[model samples]
Target chain A: MTAKTHSLERMIFFSDAVIAIMLTLLAVELPVPEVPDPLHLWGALAAHGSEYIAFLISFCVIAATWTAHHMLFVHVSRTDPQLITLNLLALLGYVLIPWASKTLGKVPNGAGVIVYATAMTFLGATMLLVLRHVVRSGLLDPTAPRGVISGIQAWSAMTTIMFALSIPAGFVLGRWTM
Target chain B: MTAKTHSLERMIFFSDAVIAIMLTLLAVELPVPEVPDPLHLWGALAAHGSEYIAFLISFCVIAATWTAHHMLFVHVSRTDPQLITLNLLALLGYVLIPWASKTLGKVPNGAGVIVYATAMTFLGATMLLVLRHVVRSGLLDPTAPRGVISGIQAWSAMTTIMFALSIPAGFVLGRWTM
Candidate 1:
């Protein structure tokens, strides 16, 4: 038996499946307040403010991460085992955002918030690794714009730092920040 | 604004994201018992055996649904408003599976299992609608194998029947079946 090369389409299909699942799962975790009546609907939701906030924050985080991932692949045309493996790891944490969001909602302290941030931290750090692999392994599509490589690197660096900083921020903000 | 045409890539990507999110969210709802010591791990987990069972059933359901979706799109090169809309409706039910599974896990009766089965029934029915839409709208790739198209239709029809039957079976079996 031989290891088969995967097309860019399949890889993207797999990744997209994972992300769609994660994004929609976030909505399920959104605190569905027991309204009992129309008058109490908005009030009940407002009561679970923390849950709403956590949901919104994680939603934005996932959306932004997707943009970055999508943009990176816009320039990527092929894949290897290592790159796919690295991507799977990132997707692991990406899918975990909701559970982490739950921890934040329930605990909303250094203990719980750190767990969420740590997961994001892992995602960010691993994303940077993927970017580095792409560049170091010469994965970029040749004849691409000269500025594209530097653009990706700079974006990855910035997001990596932001995610790294989020870890410490979780400790300081105590679930107030994602 | 004009209605925009969607590429197959974007459609697949969107579908993938939703599936991934739903699949992973099922895991989060699995009853996680507090095991302060390593020795009690198995026992604690065993206490939530039913949840695990539900998780397993739902996971398989989601995986099968994804396979069908991926396969269908393989023969589809382009899409229109109706197809996308039908797929969206199907996805709505797809994303609801985990939540219904949670209910089934907790209640484990006609009430809960029926709700779960109802969602699947919706998915199964809507999937057939998508299939029919594809056939009627002339959306299939011209070169697609004749056997493949018929096979998909037969599969969809059968699954839809099974899902429809499951709704009543939910009452008869009273949570014994998924």
Candidate 2:
């Protein structure tokens, strides 16, 4: 690979590493269920159901974000400093996911939902910004199909809109907003 | 990329992702120092110094492991089922580092040191097994230099031996084993 190609590959690898870290960090916050007796094990786990739910929700969000990123970068053949900056902005939001997820697990209230939803919204929006930057800056491969670009754009936009909507929905649905 | 190249690339990507996750998980276990007064902040942080030390030690171990993995795979032109299995075994040990780090941080006793040291030993040994498998199975590119191969072997072997030795040293040094 040429130096330019190597640079682009490194950026993708770095982004993947960051996303993977955020995804696994979701599980780090899960409390290990302890019980005086084996019989109460199930009860203890059930009591922490909200934590599990929070983990699952955040896991899905990160997974979707990674999938969109993977798809977008597959078509991207190069990177500019601005693309790198935008990617870092997206990662900043991703790095906060575990903290937000933990808070949601502990609180499971309107405030908790809002915090989690806002983090998700920020993550999604920044990722969309990355997608827009890639397209407008002509960073994609020459042969990259227009249909694929459209598909990725649609996916990113829909997720951003859903997360944005979830901010207000957090009040009405409370924990169910997850 | 051909299907075979894609498969190998995916395997490398997956390994990198797992390592990244394990590396970042070390930070998640660090407790946020809480102080009622700003003047007490440094004191509270000092009280949790062991946790920071554990995090730093584990971070270096994971970073070294990743560098070795990256070096080895750069010359690996192909992958087999056995290589994939061995890689997973290496990852199994990595996945435990955060939990071990957390235990070491909280306990900081002989037993804690032993646990953390053992985990590091397991991770290093498994990674060495991966390196040997890749070499013995002739997975490397034909153009790969013999010196690079030997250098990686030396690095992996040395790390494994050091970690193994630390298990016994843990009894004498306790927290210093980190």
Compute each candidate's TM-score over C-alphas. Answer: 0.54, 0.57
- The lowest-lDDT stretch of 10 consecutive residues in candidate 2 chain B is B169-178
Residue B18 of model 1 has an lDDT of 75
Off by over 4 Å in 2: A174-178, B1-11, B20-178
By TM-score, who's the top model here? 2
lDDT of 1 by residue, B1-178 (tens): 1223246557667777677767787766654354333344356557777777777777667665665665566677568889889989988988888888898778766777688778888888888899899888888778767786778789878877887887887788864554
Best by DockQ: 1
Q: Give me the TM-scores for chain A across all models, comma-separated.
A: 0.84, 0.91
Model 2 per-residue lDDT tens digits across residues A91-161: 89989999999988898668787788899889888988998898899998887789978887898789878
Backbone Cα, N, C clashes tallied per candidate: 13, 0
Q: Model 1, which residues run further than 4 Å from truth?
A: A1-10, A16-178, B1-9, B175-178
